[model samples]
Target: MKILLIILFFVNASTVNAKTFSVTNLANSATSEDCLDYCVDGVCFWLVCGWGCSVKTTPHINHNLPDFVVSSYNEPGENSFSEVQSLDVMKNIQGGNLTTNSKSKRANSGLKFKEASVTGNPVAYAMGQAKYLCNSKIKPYMPYYLSTLDEKMWRSGLSDMLYLSTWVPGMNEVSSNKNQTDEFLKSWGSLYPRSGFLNQKNEVKTASVIAARALEVVSDGGARIYQSSGCTSADCMKKNGKWQMISPVEENSCRAFGIESVEELKDKVDEDGQYGWTAWRNYGCCIPGPGAFIGSSITGCLN
Candidate 1:
């Protein structure tokens, strides 16, 4: 009986101390806080700077691609914020497209899939049908690929929010993948217009509006909103000197944005017992889009 008790104790302890994987490499961290700080650095560099600097790397910036893939297997729940399931989804779906094609593979919009069947009434058929359904569900989560560009279809201007949130040492054009970035901008034209946003030249500032809008499109209802690094709830104030948070109360990220109090934002708890506010707001993918300036959590109507 004592031996059995000892075995049970070890089993319980192991279960209690199990660690979950993070997309960011934080294995060298000294404490949980230090680990989280490292993840945040990745956020500031790869995510924040990424919007203005590169298009190819943008999809991999955060939990967007991975979490969406995971949600295909199971409905996204409260604790969905912390998980990264990209690799598993890729392995299950398409031999893990081990090269550049993974993100761009689905770029062709007209691709089609075979229908799943379970007519044989066997366990294998059931499993196949289930996998098919999951694949089907991920269809809408796919990101858009720019079709082409027309010089006739361009607009030029910048939002105050975009000006503040985009990369520093700004230039008329910048990106790691210059060819792709220029093509993307040419397809979408200039940044969506806004009043009173300007660059040093006193012209409308141009930021990564296309990519920003894409983030909104893919995340639609799946993620939380956040304040960009230099800005906060205070920056979301209206002309009349009052803050108006347009996102739903449950989805609000900070107190300044019409949430009754910070407590409301902090009240929600994920399945992991992490506060809902922290879970949503702190996740790298949940960064606010340009529309956060206009009191909305998403990039508003683009047309």
Candidate 2:
């Protein structure tokens, strides 16, 4: 359609002068989290109208597949993935000079900004045969480059500023409060504006905050949501997803935002100011039905 071409034209024009940087090793980043929780969740039924109907067991699979590798860094066009670096070229655009640093005007107010990008994980198909246990919404090498086209919204935080959630107290925040206290142990950042800006002081946590924002932007823009429950289609479940640390500190576990602290990693600091995370999504599937799908029931379903 005409609208789609216009969008792609701007995306290509925005990143025309950017350079790519290869940071993380995709193969080495794999962890046990890929098969986090695999179990038989429920059953599916197939019917042939007037013929007959049959039921089969279904697996409630929780695959921490690397749908996307989101990178957050100080430099523009320095995306961790070499393939999609061009999608982050903002040096030639307006407000391109603004970069994350310790002495920026925003940093003076205890807030720092960074450039973030999300690209399809190259090693997403590493599971090989094991991938048959569940289905994935994203395909390998599928680019969801929102930062390229939404530069103004991403850099200036204008989009989220108009929303009511930005003004609400404790409504759109990323924090860790072990005990219900006034002060949080670790305040990752704010979810408002859904931009590449944050108030986190730590480098690792800052990268994570921006990455989470980028992921949400892409998901909201119609990227397929992971099927985490025992359902034949992703439409049957909610659109929530999780993330797993891949670079700076590779983790074998996947968790929701603000669930864990980045300080727990032994060597949590990266000198290059770059970090990557595996976007994990859950899926449910069962053996192919012989005839038309009628109805089914599942036991011990995990939602």
Candidate 3:
């Protein structure tokens, strides 16, 4: 009892200094060629996990388009530090309520989800979604499973999001929606297996990653964004290029141009929203190429 108490006291003392935050199990250096194996049909694992993630995560680079799910589409590039993901905001949804209801198309200016735990399909994004904690308030957030897709898209989003923490950026501290959550998990699990896919429609060979995700909430669907050990093919950059960094969008603009932190780039309503990263190098390296120019004037799009 005495030793146990001593250990507990030290542990508590350390907790007072720093808080533990949960993050996805993805590594830092991810590449594009990683998609070659998973691209398929029905299996939807490709669609469910990889391809779908690609579309939602990458809206600015649509060299190719898919038939179903998400279409490959890249918003025109910008000269700012941040690259915004702005869509046409579809004047209307073809058959769904987006056009009929009028409310979903612009509900809460599309900033809120009325507790999917109660109101959405137990599958899809409605699953793995969560409510987070920021400061003294709690708010909605996608879980690490879903947010894994977020990690793949932007470098510092997880951290930026945690920092901006419009609300505490942690998950489901408490939720009465377990039944729905389980149902949703079952559906998701059927699609994504512990190692290989259980569903015959898909057959995935885990190369360097323990997990994967297709960003559905962002980009309306286009490419698959996932976190893995690194590049798979020798010709990695051949398809997906590295995230290049730039600086100071304008000489004196408050929002410097470059790669906007995920949150800023994700929710921003500008052409070049990628240029607004809150951290220059707080967490890690900013990046190179796309937005890096030590001291060059506006020669073109980024830096």
The best candidate by lDDT is 2
CA RMSD of each candidate after superposition: 23.6, 9.1, 25.1
- Tens digits of per-residue lDDT, candidate 2, 1-303, equal 432333233334322211222323444444453434556566676655446545443333333455567777766666666666665675565333444444555433446666777666645544422434454555556666446556677777676666675676555556545342322334566666677766766666677778777776665432222222222213321222466665656566666556555566428566556676677555556645566665556676465
- lDDT by candidate, in order shown: 0.20, 0.55, 0.18
In terms of TM-score, which candidate is strongest? 2
Q: Per-residue alpha-carbon lDDT of model 3 for 1-303, expressed as tens digits?
A: 532333233334322111111111000101112211112111111112344332111111111100001111111221111111122122222111111122333322321110000001111111112111001111112121122223232222232233222133222111112354543332212111111111211101010011111111221212323222122322222111121111211111122122233354333222211121110100101112222233222222221
lDDT of 1 by residue, 135-181 (tens): 11122222121101111111122222255323422222222223544
Report the alpha-carbon TM-score of model 2 versus the true structure.
0.70
TM-score, every prediction: 0.17, 0.70, 0.15
For candidate 2, the C-alpha RMSD (Å) to the true structure equals 9.1
What candidate 3 gets wrong by more than 4 Å, as runs, is: 1-107, 110-275, 280-303
Model 2 error, position 145 (Å): 2.8
Instruction: List clash counts for every candidate, in order.
Output: 1, 3, 34
